[model samples]
Target chain A: MYRYDEFDQAFVAERVTQFRDQVARRLAGELNEEQFKPLRLQNGVYLQLHAYMLRVAIPYGTLSAHQMRKLAHIARTYDKGYGHFTTRQNIQFNWPRLDDVPAILEELAEVEMHAIQTSGNCIRNVTADHFAGVAADEAADPRPYAEILRQWSSLHPEFLFLPRKFKIAVTGAAHDRAAIQFHDIGYEVKRNEAGELGFAVYIGGGQGRTPMVAKKIRDFLPEEDLLAYSEAILRVYNLHGRRDNKYKARIKILVFETGADVLKEEIEAEFTKIRASALRLPADEIRRIEAYFAPPAYAIALPGEAALAAARQADPGFDRWVASNVTGHRAAGHSIVTISLKPIGAPPGDATADQMDAVADIAARYSHDEIRVSHEQNLVLPHVATADLRSVFDALVTAGLATANAGLITDIIACPGLDYCALATARSIPVAQRISERFAETARQADIGDVKIKISGCINACGHHHAGHIGILGLEKKGEEVYQITLGGSGDETASIGDIVGRGFASDDIVDAVETIVDTYLERREGADESFLAAYRRLGATPFKKALYGAA
Target chain B: MANETARLWKDGGFRPNPWQDWPEDGALEPLDPGTDALVPLERFVADPDVFLARKGRLGVRVAAGEDVAVLAEHLENIALIALEFPSFADGRNYSAARLLRERLGYDGEIRAVGDVLSDQIALMRRCGIDAFLVTHGPTRAALQGGRIPEVRHYYQPVSGPEIEIPAGSRPWARQPAA
Candidate 1:
């Protein structure tokens, strides 16, 4: 939760007025289609297949109760009674009129939000661990760095219009919840021999028409030289990255074209020139920025704070939610409460207006009014007291938000496919809903263990299928929605893209296809605690493919 | 986007019945000349000697030997400094325009010619572009060009060297572009 300073506030406010004028001119017939196309896009107002979709940046998936309520208000007043929370930790309203966008932007600015750089070729909303300051295992909060990048990249003169959209995600944990390895630019917070915190930088990792695990360029980039080093990378890409064909435009294509070694050499040379200059982060500024994301005050210790054990002994319903949704906290008396959006039949990342309000109220009451939108398409009450876990679970159940599928089999990261998105080739929600139905039994889900089932409607990989433990890609085959499953992908410190297990399954067979893989894992897994990814690595896709395809 | 209201207008464009004295809007307004067409920057033939001496060069300047630091050389003389916006995203011209006026301080007919859009008029002025040359069409035609890229711009720069009536401010004319 970084609050806007005068500079940040002024910058966003001015951008809103700028967009308002641009919209006025367009409506007045002062600008034509060709001239206005790029303008609209840069502001995150897209002319989709159906209507204009404005994507509001929820920077790194963090939101205060105020911001959430504002989004809910926007949904009620300007759009259909809902908003689609995207995988990048942003929100998209599907049916905004072209002319009303500036007004929409004006309203968003009131909440310290604007749509700048949300859709442009510039550095996008810098994503970080959604559990940044809350997770018990976190080495350091990643939001300070994310916020720093946000301020520097907003309307960055040189890199605004790049060859294609750029994405960066950061994580401080040894376990990668942020999916850093799958982004265009990924940063893993690591400590060197001297115990200095810096980033292990990865470049060219992305999923689109071509998927790649970003190759590491810097073993450790000193924290201070982040901007200079990033500029060096983007400058290199801008000068050399392809623009001839849209498909080959991403930095991944360059990595593929000029091998990682050559690219790394070029970046290092470029970094040397800028690192010794003004772009370097001074210690004071870094500390000032870091202070915005300081952890909430928590009691050092709670005697017998095994609230989970107490709740489990008292109530079965609370026990199920606690077992699945409650996770480790950085503070002794606090726990990370994940509010699952994936109900039995609803879309994975959608929130109805009322549900949004309820979550906001819950966050305000039980969790310091701070809310986090996970890349997994779930909301997180990041710093809830461990003692209040059961009460929060109770409120969630009443609101129909309690699904007990945080990291379990049914906890799916889904993209808005053909149903709402213009880029989708098939329906991802239906596929996710079907799989969730197959694993609806609480006991069955608990027994199956933590398996990330990510479904992407198309190659954009918004659902993060590449990092899912079991990635399901919904594609069109001869005009029918077919699902292709991949095994063993991970999004942590040891991240890897899931390998295709076998041929795709038809829409009807997708659920059975998932069940088939799970059955294989159960039979071959060495023990109960070894998760799906561990088993897949131990056994590989060959065993799973055989299990699904049979003999052949 | 609104087609119904568009058909009601005659040539000069949609005025209700009692319109005032204006051209019937037949021939489109020709664009102002480009640097190559104008005689200044286009005149310096590979060197700055002749242009500096004010010899017979009646053309616009790419850069006369009058180094920005040697401002004493050309104080009274009028010149034009045109910022080339190769593309909208390239902000080099933005800084270049600001320095030419506020810092190194060139007092001349500052012009933003290439790829100039009407919406940027206010900004171009603040940064010092006094005149403009629309590359493709007449100014009126350029006005109808699709969506304006930004609803708001952080800086003040105009599309051309024109005195902008800031949205709600009183109409007070400051020193014009040159």
Candidate 2:
């Protein structure tokens, strides 16, 4: 929702020109692959298994209709007419040539977007709750603070090449939709007892080969000291994080190696010295950023409960979609609508060019010309009128974007596994597709209730399988793709990594194993009212393990 | 060997390095008085008084993982602080350079020595590193020619003069005057 001013415009324009020169140098053999690798990565270009994948940043998961249209245009012109939305709330174009990258960047710049920091060991795209301003339980819209961090960390001179890539996520609501606990640094916007705003800072949390839920480093850091405190954390990590082993290079390992108390002392010392510097965000600047995220003008009216109920009675499909996809909004007469990108048997987050265009059109018409990409691999119309829900659903259905499974068994989050990623040891998309097809019936998925199935192709956990209700991690055991199942992981306010059930199953047996686990939950649940996550919490992984592999 | 032709970039141009530097061959020794000697921090810390007594320009070569805070008290006396990169991916020195400039307010020459590639030159410069001890021929040529591609506008405030946003304009839109 934030518009680019002239300075921001020129900054991105110049970056495009700079990247264009880099590409030219690479093509002319003036720079080798080793020399060009970091440069290309900083601009979001990756040398994947099949082709160069360019990931474009959607800062704070916010997009305008015009920007969505431009993304569709890019997918149509440069890529293979489709783009995959990643778990970081960014989108990836899997097929873009080296030469076309600069052109693609130029187009992205026109729409106030770029691929900067989407890859490489720099401060990555700052993410926040997708329902930041619109959510009912929000303390403050976290986007303002997230945008401040975006500006502060972009091409940060001191942190350009950290020991490893750094990820920062912010969440405004008490619900924690941003998965704050799994990031390198997570900020939960909080208000003190005196009613002054600040942040509850968590550090040293990440999921890769090693998974860690972030530990709280500061109970309450004043909002004004945000950048300075962040600098302190980064400075400590940059100066001390391991550089010898790439696997142990993350800040999480540093916090683990040197106890959290020692790390906190170091961070506090650094913060003391730098807290009064110019990096401390000014009040006017905070207010200026907050103005950009103010709620859209809404028609004051009662909730559209009667009309929604009548429509649901008329069409069970619409009723099911409303039940799963619609979420409460802060403003009356408006609801947050999630358009499921995880359609049956398709890649978890892939949206065709036509689908993107249709969503853009729907946003322009039914919503307030704004779109949001959810970390669960879905697009959100944050301010859809409750009356327009059916119309929007109809348009989405026509464009193949309608899937009545949000937060249901069929709605899955999966990484680009062996199909595209060079780091993948096993295939992830096919596994997600198989599970989706196995539970394609809407009634069955609704009956099963909210069970998140997340899959990752490797240990990197890019698919965030560690946070799934039923987590599946694909590994190569003696040249065979084996699926390891974990149960009872959740990424909400009460964040916890899932535990592995037992020995992994072969790829052929994974789908049936998942079904058995789901059926096990259905039988073991207190009632249909209790979700899979809640049931798993009540009954630990023992029953699920027994269901997957026979009782030991 | 290419090391013989290694050029030093300082004060916006390349020049032959005046200071004599030791090879990073895992050895430490006292300073040689006739020529400027850059010794490892451990060597210098073993006998700071001996290094201080030398009647020549003194410098210290710090590895990426070394605690740079040890050099804080000696910032005013040291002529150069050479930060090693070990590998281009190891970016600890970038933080070290900023600490020297911003935290310690050390204004003397800060040279990026090892694995100083062309792509990182602009970044190193922005972090208050004013010099480079470059061995790669093409990288040296690019530095000498001022051909390292860089964006003029910056989003973050660093160790340089803050470009004031024009009054009545959005602060983020302000760019450094051409």
Scored by lDDT, the top model is 2
Give TM per candidate. Answer: 0.81, 0.97
Calculate candidate 2's fnat: 0.75
Predicted structure with the largest DockQ when compared to the true one? 2
**DockQ of each candidate, alpha-carbon based:** 0.09, 0.61
Report lDDT (Cα) of residue A181, candidate 2.
89
Clashes of each: 44, 1
Model 2 lDDT per residue over A1-552, tens place: 798877678879988998998899899998899888989999999999989999999999999999999999999999889999989999999999999999999999999999999999889999999999999999999999999899878888778788899999999978899999888999999999999999999998888889988889898999999998999999999888887788999999999999989999999999999888777777888998899988888877956779889999999999999999999988888899999999999999999999999999999998889999999999999999988888998999899988999999888999999999999999999999999999999999989988989999999999888999999999999999999998888888899999998999899999999999988888998999999889888998888887776777
Estimate, for each residue in A1-552, the C-alpha lDDT of model 1 and write its tens digit. Answer: 677655456667767777777677778876677777767887898877788899999888888999899999988888898888878889889888887888888888888888877896778888989899887777678888887777667665446657788999999877888878788889888789999989999999888758788898888989998887887788678667776687898898998899999998988887875576546677777887788788766656764366568768888777888889988886787889888988976788888888899999999998888999888888999888887887888898888999998999998988888887788999999888888888899988988899999999998777788888999898998998888887888877788888987788889888988898899899988888999989989887888878788878
TM-score of 1: 0.81
DockQ of 1: 0.09
Please list the residue runs of candidate 1 whose C-alpha ends up more than 4 Å from where it truly belongs after superposition: A303-307, B1-178
Model 1 Cα shift for residue A11 (angstroms): 1.9
**Per-model lDDT:** 0.74, 0.88
